[model samples]
Target: MSYKNILVTGGCGFIGSHFIHHLLKKYKDINLVNVDLLTYCGNPENVRDIADDSRYNFYKADIGDYNAMSSVLKKHQIDCIVNFAAESDNNKAVSSPVDFARTNALGTAVLLEAARQAGVKRFHHISTCEVFGQLPLKSKSKFSEKSPYNPRTPYNAAKASGDLIAKAYHHTFGLPVTISYCANNYGTHQFPEKVIPVFAIRAIQNDPLPVFKSSGNKREWIHVSDHCSAIDLVLEKGRAGETYNVGTGLEKTVTNIADDVLAILKKPKTLKKIVPDRPGHDSRYLLDSSKMKKLGWKPKIKWHEGLEETLNWYKNNPKWWQPLLSRSNSWK
Candidate 1:
């Protein structure tokens, strides 16, 4: 298949930016149209290498707008649409459920409608494992694509609703859609509000590390680079109307994650404090990504190495993150 033009929503955000960088490097002929709202998390600087590239284009627009999306789709001649745009932060979602519903759920519907109208070849919905709700830490079975949706937080509920809408489009309209539910992604270009980068920033500043919900909550972690790699594989080779799980299979508690971050930063573990957990915080989240692996896709980056690289990125790029950290409302 000679894929040419592709659209990646939320392109300047963490995983989306990394995905765009990876795609541009690997596929020489592919032209990219990245649509993002420049929300608190979306930073164009994250993809500066390709900013000047002729193959890449960006539009600062919200996906919730149908006419704007339709215009962009028609103008770009987009062959594939990767829906990565979403409101993902738990705290933010709690405080602003309406915004979450608008972006994650309704915005996805708008994109699907546009893709259907534009007759795109493939539409991939990038989602999180949190939509499965809390998996018990002691449970032996990991969540598969067959798991029932049980979103616990406003953020995840919105995402779950979006997934349903995508599924509806695929089944009802035959929109040629695929969904990939991924574990918690940690890597470069991630905003500081997320767990990994937040801890790294706090540790770097010798500040207190806030451990929500006793720091006992466990989660499977995947590198954003590995995530992007899987997403690319799916876009290029995946079967339509199917859901794939993307993860590193590394399940560790929040405390363990904090310890690892401290070790990476050469800081004492004493910096961590058990703080009040977020409302409806999932106790554990793990995904069985073997389905994608069976399709010849596997994660390449290990957590330790990936974590070290992420720490180095934040340490070296204070200019990029300092301004982000100063925005207390966004971070909170």
Candidate 2:
């Protein structure tokens, strides 16, 4: 509510679209300018329901385009920029590392520069805990802000680069920046490639669920709505030049997820098909969300309730998720 007009990059994507909806519904006086490239993953249907809202506007443009970014910032009188734009798939990164770097690294730099030129009041960058590398599967260890970057894949390395650039802009240029490394997000409107959706969609069709060889890879899952709430808090109350980890501590293995999907949809356990794991696939990812807790922000979604609702969403919305299945490659 403090910022009258906010620019949300990648607003058509899963998390971004949810955040945009959260902001518009929570703050009546605010205006949102959604900037998205509408890439293979950025579906307009994610936010099409709000297309006619007087406070919402969408612009199709790449985040790396400085001229276009700067123009939109000024044209919308944007006071803050929440960057959610990036090439998010690791499978794609395997064959196209440069493409990942181009958007995740260089594009972030360009957007930060544009924000500097436009004198935005606040700049919040979205990041992943994968930048801190994999943790031992059985250990109690978790990723924190103080952890060093040890990205395993090209996609994560590029995201790590983007995080560094955001910190640099804040320290060197005095940009009011706050970055967040959130846990794995699961909910409706997510591209069908990620583990949860892949299981849900396959289970609905009684198709074989592709489970990575070990299928024991563990990751903390946070409902996308909770992640959006944390972002809202960071934008409003977080200190500049700081990074916060957002997670629910609801860690579960990929096998556990597939099982849950199978049971939820009354499918047989035999639907799980063990597949080869992808390169640079981590064994575990858990975040120490003490910082976000200190800020009085915590996730509210219960795992069973949240996951079931998410799976049911994919079950009911086949038209939206079914078409995108072909775009995904064999990935963990």
Candidate 3:
């Protein structure tokens, strides 16, 4: 349960950074090695505060590169691996499906091989409920760990492949792997490409905040901190080859989310503009997190509370998300 040296892939990203912080704060004696390829969304500044700690080390490497992953594992003498590396943008995945496949599928395969060779004690993978595809509007249905995968987008398809690959390794090679499928995450340090930050920044600038006209489409949202905590609990008590779903039962349409962000910034409602929905956009994503709750992890932050706090974060820190606008604004 206690990992002496844990290698966290993609630790510079939003959710991964939060997980690293959680681990460092909870376990003082453990050392962490963060491996991030530093893609457009993966910013080192996200974890800059903890970069100087003696207990932390970082490497810039691709998870798909077997040699690089093996090197990092051996150098850090990692006993546990927590993987977050992926090309996660849905819109971008539509245009560049190959890129997503390489990272989500091939990258996972290579990482698992490296972990098996290193004989790591545990390998925990983070996943999305989108892999289960959409639910009907206003439906009570939710994605359980047992739900059949119905990925609608190239991104989710690739992620589904990665999850299957991980499971295969556990079944065939006896690799100790635990996977968690979570609802969408919102929190501080999230890339501007996401909904909350995009709305907040555009509202701050009095620019149009784009929203698809899918009034019935719903998405379950959970605070990044809550999701991170779920992963931590899994590492401690979860069984290998088992998958858990993490969510708060919180569902909201994008229109509602845009309105909330504007309200938080005291901006006018006119800032919200209806835009054409992207290709392969799922109509809904809901998750049944009772499995995770059974492990003593539950969502702590409410939707409005988390949204306001997240918008405030963007308002107070322009330097962090401003530079990202040009880097990944188009997501091409």
Candidate 4:
């Protein structure tokens, strides 16, 4: 797909900012517009370096607002649309499923309609492996594109609904849309509420890292940069109406990941406090990103190296996270 302009929703957030950075560096000819609601987790400072670029534009808009999003699409002449905007906190979803449904599901539908009317060439929707719900450790299998919908959390359920909508858009209207389901992403610029960053922030503050389960809950880990690369490949070359899984295929226990973080911070792993697991916490989840690998996309940063680099970024960005940490309840 030959495209000159791209529209990215939620560009100020974790994966979206990384995607913007990757796009700007990889393509000099394309113009990029980022639309985000600037929610608590969404920080514009994450994109301060690129805010001044002539080819970059940021719109303080919500994807849930159809009229506003349509106007932005018409104004920007967006050729490609990547939807990453969502209310993505598990705790928040538990607290407010209606909010999750509105943003992740209804908002995606609104964007799909806008993209269709704008005659966008490519529409890529970012999704999560959590949509597969919890896989049993005894099963010893990874979820593929063919995996059934078994969402266990409100957040994943909303994402699954969005995925279904995207698929229907392609099937019914012939809208050019591709969906990418990805594993857990960790890197710099992530809000500290996430697992890795939360642990890093707590460790920095001399607080205990909260471990919800026995620490044996298994998960697939992938670097955020690797995920951005995979998304790029999918946006550029992925087949429409197809779903691709993106991950490093590196599986590790939650306990081991926390211990690894402590090791990187040069702190003892003894600060881990086991707590009652979250309601309906999935025991294990995995993804088969072989389809993405077949498209010539593979992870560059190893887990150990990436984890250390993420730790150091948090250490240096005290000014960036200080205010956020003060208001957040994760540490307490």
Candidate 5:
């Protein structure tokens, strides 16, 4: 499936920006349209290197605004829509459930309707593994495409609702839609509020790194580049209405991650501070990405090397992230 014009929502964000760069480099003739609300986490500087590319265009608009999204879709004659716009910060979601629902769920519905009306060829919804809730530490379970929805956080609940709405559009309106539930992603340009970036930045500054609870909670980690590759595969070959889990099948505990970051920076381990866990903190998250693997997609980056590279990125890119820390209180 060749796409001439692709509409990518939240393209200013971390993973979205990386995907946009990937798309541009891989397809010379592809014209890319980025629709971003420019929320707190959305930074245009993430893709500043490609800002002047002729094939790339950007529009500052909210996904939930039907008229706005419709205008962009019709104007671009977009054949594919990759919806990445959402309020994804879990802590912010806990305090701002209404905002999460409006963006993640309602916004997705609005995008689907616009895509359906505009006769878009493919609609890809990027989701997270938290929709399956947490797995027990000793459990051998892993979330798959068929995992039942059991969202425990406002963030995951909104995402799960968005995923269902996307599927519903496919089933009821015959809209071509594919959903991907990815594990935790870490890479350059990620906002500092996320676990990896937060710890890396703090360790670079020689500040205390906060570890939630006992830091035993575990999460599967996948590099952002690998995730971008998986999404490309899904968009090219994934069946409509089918869901795929994108992960590296690698798990790391929070303490382990913090320790690794500090060690990479040669910072003392004493900077590790055990903080109270967030409300409704999940114990573990594991994903069985065999379904996506069957599509000939596999993660290329090793966790250790990826972690070190990510830490070095934060250390070297203070100009890109330091200003963001002051703008938002969520960084703490």
Candidate 6:
């Protein structure tokens, strides 16, 4: 079923903004309503180019605020909701666990309830691979859809709670819902705080790339565009009350990523420095995305090519990232 009026929470944020742009370009008759709180990472510049489109509208509101979300849904006559709003930073979540719970967990429940009450056609929840916790450094096993939730960080714990709540809403209330857990995403317009952007920017500036102790910590990586495509597929064909994992099946370690970035920029490998690992740091994360693949969705971008394109983006767009440097300090 094709949806006409869609409410995309956190539309001004990285992945949400990209998804909005993709939808606007792909569907001519669809109307999109973007709800974003414009937090530190949510920058208006991300979607400023599409701000004036007749079919697209923007609302400066928090999804956690039930009254605000309700008003927007009613005002827009929304039929479908793609939820991307949450406190997603691991370090920040450790420092402020309450904020994570309030946003990732409580906020999700609030939005789910609102969607149920409004009779929205479908509620798609965007989640993270961290909810399955880490795998042994030398283990070959990957986390599948049936993998038990074993969140290690405050951020993942909160996201896990949100996923469970979404499931509960579907089983208990029969509200149409689908959940997707995705691997680490890297692409253009990403905030400099994330690993890819941070390393890219630091490499370009000849700054030391900080590697956590035991740089062998591995993560599955996927381009933001691929992740968005998977989400769209889930919204269109995914069965209600089902969970799908999305990833490229490619894995790289922290040191390997940093080295690759430096190599792409023709910089010295000596710039890599080992630093203390963050609290509750996971050693590795791997996902088995066979479920999403069976749904006719697969990642298109290879890590090396995507990494170069992303590095070039950061290297060329100084104005977009320069202003955010002061705020990004806290993330470091």
TM-score of 1: 0.97
Q: After superposition, how far is residue 239 of candidate 6 from its true place, in Å?
A: 0.8
Off by over 4 Å in 6: 330-332
Q: In model 5, how large is the Cα lDDT of residue 289? A: 95
Candidate 5 lDDT over 1-332, as tens digits, reads 37889999999999999999999999899999999999988998988899899999999999999999999999989999998899988988877789999999999999999999999999999999999999999777898889899999999999999999999999999999999999999999998888888898888888899899848889999999999999999999999989999998899999999989888899999999998888988899999999999999989999889988888888888999999996555564
The sequence of per-residue lDDT tens digits that candidate 6 reaches over residues 43-146 is: 99999999899999999987888988888888888999999998878877877899889889999999999998889989999999999999999989999999
Residue 15 lDDT, candidate 4, scale 0-100: 93
The backbone clash count of each candidate, in order, is: 0, 0, 0, 0, 0, 0
How well is each residue in 255-315 modelled by candidate 2, as lDDT tens digits? Answer: 8988888988899999999989899899999999999999999799999999889988898
Off by over 4 Å in 2: 330-332
Clashing pairs in 4: none
Give the per-residue lDDT of model 4 (tens digit) for 1-332. 36888999999999999999999999989999999999878999989999889999999998988899889989999999989999898877776789899999999999999999888999999999999898887777889999999998989999999999999999999999999999999999888777888889888887898988657988899999999988888987899989999978788887988899888898887889998877878888889888998999989999999999999999998999888875454754
lDDT of 5: 0.92
Estimate the lDDT of model 6: 0.91
lDDT tens digits, residues 105-167, model 1?
999999999899999999999998988888776787788999999998889999999999999
Which residue pairs in candidate 6 collide? none
Lowest summed lDDT window (length 10), candidate 2: 323-332
* lDDT agreement with native, every candidate: 0.89, 0.92, 0.90, 0.89, 0.92, 0.91
CA displacement after TM-score superposition, residue 276 of candidate 5 (Å): 0.7
TM-scores for the candidates:
0.97, 0.98, 0.98, 0.98, 0.98, 0.98
User: Would you give me the overall lDDT of model 4?
Assistant: 0.89
Any runs in candidate 4 off by more than 4 Å, and if so which?
Answer: none
Better of 3 and 5 by TM-score: 5
